[model samples]
Target: MNLVFLYGPPAAGKYTIGRELASLTGLALFHNHLVVDSVAAVFPFGTPAFRRLREQFWMDVFEAACAEDRSLIFTFQPEGSVAPDFADRVRQMVTKAGGTILFVYLTLSHEEQVQRVANADRGKFGKLRSVDLLQSLQADFEACERAMPPPDLTIDTGTTEPSESAHRICALMRDHGLAR
Candidate 1:
């Protein structure tokens, strides 16, 4: 199995681009927000219940993805400092499934991310709880380079057209023999 993990700050368009890439490449897309959004509807943000549900959902998804004999695209925003154990769990899961995992980190200008989140139409999965929170989290994500490995590919979509960014990702995947 092939798994592409797309991660970035909120409203960096990981979901938007992940969905489009799934359509174009015939890969299943399990975006980070999809699960969180679903659970957020009922639970208050930052509650222990919400965190538990989120952890369960991601663990299940990773397990399921491991079982499948197909390629997939998953978006994530792992609080870099949360815990190393969780990341280790993900690595072990993928390794056991005989799957290879690739990381794709997308970054854009702060102004652009804020605009996207602020202007976004809230979906059924819920929405960003606070703009200030998103900003702080992103700043933290950026401050620590050791938090996450250098991505397999880093694309800055703030200046490029959305489609162009998608093309760039697909190109990298193809070049690396991760996609058709």
Candidate 2:
């Protein structure tokens, strides 16, 4: 099994690029919003209950996927040092299942990030779609100095097409002797 973690700030194209990567590699896509949106349906976002449920669901899914020997592509938006405990949990699951992990960090220029956030067709998921909300989120993310993790691969989505980015990621995986 192989785990590919795609992480970045909001509007960085993690979902779009992860979709392309999953298509190319035939891996299961486990985007962060899957859990976030689900939990948000009940508990309000940023509440303690919401956070606990979201984290619990995410870990449970990861554990099951790893145990079943399923390759997966997961996406996240880091809030601080990529949540060391969460990363460690994933590592534990993968290790127990004899799987390897590949971390991909997507990035975009500040201007492009804002533009994408304002895109009419963009999926809001559980997030507020207003420009003011987006700006506030971006500002909060930037204020967290230790949010992002060191990545095995980094893609500038503002300058690359999703298909091309997927191709590059797949090539990198192949070079690392990973099947996908």
Q: Pick the candidate with the highest TM-score.
A: 2
TM-score of each: 0.83, 0.89
**Candidate 1 wrong stretches, greater than 4 Å:** 80-85, 122-124, 136-138, 141-146
Tens digit of per-residue lDDT, candidate 1, span 35-115: 877777889666888878888988887887678766688887756534436655776788688877777888888788777
What clash pairs does model 1 have? 37-125
Give the 10-residue window scoring lowest on summed lDDT in candidate 1.
120-129
